[model samples]
Target chain A: MTERLNEDQPIFIQIAELIETSIVEGDRLANEQVPSTNEFAKHYQINPATAAKGINLLVDQGILFKKRGVGMFVTEDAKQIILAKRQERFYTHYVQPLLQEAKRISLTQEQLLDFIKEGFSHED
Target chain B: MKISATDLNKIYKKEQALNHLSLTLEGNKIIGLLGKNGAGKTTLMRLIAGHFQPTSGQLEINGQSPFNHYSITRDVCLIQENYNFYEKFTIDDILKISAVFYPNWNASEAEELVTLFKLKRKRKISALSKGMLSAVGIIVGLASHSPITIFDEPYIGLDASYRSTFYDLLLQSYQEDPRLIILSTHLIDEVSKLFEEVAILHDGKLLLHEKAEDLAENHCIVSGPVKEVDKAIEGKQVLHQSTLLGQKTAILYDQEIDGNYDSLTFSKASIQELFVYLTKEEVVKHGDRN
Candidate 1:
């Protein structure tokens, strides 16, 4: 996932989210050593301090931990921590927007649920 | 290393190149010095490099004036866009001279970078193309490893690929031995992300100096219907605004959009957009007087 960072948000937050997505998607597993701040800076062509800020955010949240002079490593509960965090914001970030769009379109709640079911069926 | 300028002013005959400009830069950082042409960026850099003394005010590098002070100037390396190397000297000869001038100069790194940029060692300075000359400057700046390095539009005739190479090499060198690096360039969008802090100059004055992340967090561009946009931006510091058809878009500084405003769409104002709008507003204001 070599996607470029977007301008709509802070680069460090985007960097943190990228790492979190990797953890949740199983691309980076528990206890795995993460790339150093310098590595992230060179890859994204961003300031190393900015990249360090991103890694430190995860460290503050306990999703990652630093080893003295070694490197950063994913915490054992990183996936669970990230999943729970995302789920906590799902209602506000996703559901609220979905409901607002549906209201703007004058779609009834029943129609919205049926449409979601149909969408799920297509996935199956 | 620390650089502090207090009420610094530099005037050239009838022109006021710098007007009471004061800024402090310390520690190891990659700072972006941004401004339009004739905005006093070069004057400021030259003062820091000890090229000339300021007309008034004080500039200190580590508690001492940089002007004619070898103790301070020796640690500072300022590479301008048009570096005037001896036309008769070959590329190899210039590097050798630089090795003698800069005490911390890395000969091996300079040699490697010269090869990387594909310059002929035996070619005289006068025989190189414009882009080749720029590569020579870049090589010197990076290999010097001076504690306080300043690059004022270091990339002039270099193409896109070579510019990218310069940025990479700059970061690599900084990582190896952390130092204060001041970069001044108009190509904001391409290299803005590399700066830990950004300082914008306008009309020989300091307009803004803040952390890059803080700037990204506080400034944004919001657009929507004229009435809604007007309502959304009321009481906020609007740096720049435009209207087309029935829609209005405005750049807001130090203001955040509330999600309650459903009609308004907001996006972060990139450093380039912010610089343009911030400086453009002053130009328009000046134009009104004329």
Candidate 2:
């Protein structure tokens, strides 16, 4: 794998994050086999040991499971588990910041509700 | 599973291909054998495969010399880049030959990959494109299930999608069988992940054989304002540099850097750049013993 050698974070951590997001986004589905450690290495052009470390991190978090004679598969409850983990990061990571921005902008609840409705319309 | 190469030397006229090169590969892990053009990568592969004898040294696979031993040859499969096949023979005929040679040949696995690669068994090997021929070679290599398999630059003319498919299949096979695999390639950005240990060669000599993570950890690229980057990178071994806009980006060789700096981003060094620096005769790193 050709690793991205940016100093912002360790390459292994980036790999772990990518794999985690892959699972959460359904890029790698529940119960479906994911790439082998070496496959991750080749896909990203990284060392196999580093790839294995990233894979093992997901395994450690119960996001993925290994099948003997086969390969790694997304955990059965991957979606629910990640959703719960994401939920645990609510106020500290996202909500409080949005609220602070809203206060700074002097935004009211009605205006925010209107903004949410507009966002929903844009998606459609 | 130990292979010892001692004082191995090969010369073609004035150019020394392999210069007294000797190293031992531990068993059951992926290894990356890397070097510049004409650095004797193919020669090493052929030598270990017993295709040719070294001028001065010998290669031993599992304590037995692979030279002139059909038993060892049966278990060792070396896939040369740009493999050539007989124009008259179809892919099926080659599969049959493989079945006879390799004791652990998996027919079902071969068939699956043949279809996965969209290979036509009835087509003559001479009719396949460069990529298709590579696919045929890969099918045989994976299906052979050899104890020790070496791929010398497998993805030469392949398209991106085909290359990705090759990597997927290689990983799947390795996971299932868990044997020794060695790959040599120049497209470092595309296939660096397949390596467990990287053995870099310079002038037909082994430079370093360490983990892939270590290679990235050992080097970085620093880019920001020219003044700041230059000041911070002073006295460091700069592999390459360029000025884009008002910023300067310098490639640093092997430094311990914790990921924390204002207005500066740290990333891993490209293996290609490292190769160029390593092959150059004058570049120096104060603490780099290798």
Candidate 3:
């Protein structure tokens, strides 16, 4: 069976999110070369057109830059840009879900806040 | 290359194989033909390849019927699961014959595929394993370079790694040269990523033909407490539903799901899951009519 990059979303979106995370995590630093569309297609076993679509998402966000005859490279402010975009998504993608789950189990707001603080204190 | 099937009907004696099926496909792109067994996938492929005559209506490739038409037939190649070769012929001999059949056949590419598949060139067709036979079929289908190529369950016995290799080569070759490629397989999840469009046949009729990405985006699954799930999917097209005790999950189609729910979680369904749900709806509809 083909391996899924992420089972919850479309492959192109997953591809874009994957690179965005890598940039935010500093695994792919600014000015470092990113894989070409063909490389991404082969690595993910997806169509090259789909891979191009994913890469284009980053290009549209100004997170990846393309040089003539050379492969794509991370923009100088790619990490910052990704951080900003992800922060915008953080509320819906993480915070809302967290609150919803907390409500589902009848956890009080103060209790949830205390748990979060306790959790952060133990973080390395 | 353009393939048009209008009100196409195929009847095999007493059984109806295709029912007024109509579809128009143009341009060079990969299309996945997905359906349950005996859903007229083979019938459609055979009709397009000129192996079977339609009982009614029409199917034309480039404005000409593919049946016994040498000019159009040469441009269309269909490789079925049980592809036949001379039992005594070696792989090399078969490749030589294929070159004559497919004018644009690439011998070097075939050689490369043979090496990748680790097949002995001189091995007789009868001596190869099932997986090796499937690999040979994939090699010919890819190396043929036909304008419109159809593969019906091409990777039957291929292992996961070999299957991934085939997918890689297929994408690479398609990037190099775009063509109208149709693939019919039950392994929808494995190959859905490569398809630009997907056509589903159900009960000998054209069920759906949608862009693969749009189909995935158009449907979603909502799961949680029975009451919340029911309320969330109210008035929507629920393709399938499963319930256990107080929890329930329903797959909804053509609905925009947003907002945060206290007890419900929404998730996207895989192509295979969507197929099952969609076709299951058809089954339930038929049952209701009965």
Clashes of 3: 0
Candidate 1, CAPRI quality class derived from DockQ: medium
Using DockQ, rank the candidates from best to worst: 1, 3, 2
Off by over 4 Å in 2: A1-11, A19-49, A55-124, B243-246, B257-263, B276-290
lDDT of 3 by residue, B1-290 (tens): 99999999999767899999999887888899999998899999999999877999999999999998989898988888875577899999989999999988989999999999999999999998889999999999999999999999988788999988988888888888899999899998899988888999998898899987788788888999998888788888788888999999999888876555766777888888888877863436545674
RMSD of 2: 7.5
Write one digit per residue (lDDT tens) for candidate 1, span A1-124: 4878988889999999999998998989998988899999899889999999999999999999999999999999999999999999999778987988899899999999999999999995
Give the alpha carbon lDDT tens digit for every residue of A1-124 in model 2.
2335443445677787776677778787888887787666556645566777878877888988999889888888877787888789877567766766798699998998898799999996
By lDDT, rank the candidates, best first.
1, 3, 2
When only the first chain is scored, the TM-scores of the models are 0.92, 0.72, 0.91
- TM-score, candidate 2, is 0.71
Output the lDDT of residue A2, model 2.
Answer: 35
Pick by DockQ: which candidate is best?
Answer: 1
TM-score of chain A of 3: 0.91
Summarize candidate 1's per-residue lDDT along B1-290 as a digit string, tens digits. 99999999999667999999999999899999999999999999999999999999999999999998888998998988985588899999999998988889999999899899999999999999989999999999999999999999998999999999888999889999899999999999999999999999999999999999999987888888999999888888888889999999998898776657766777787899889888874546655785
Q: Over 4 Å off in model 1, which ranges?
A: A99-115, B244-246, B256-259, B281-290
| Candidate DockQ scores, in order | 0.78, 0.25, 0.71
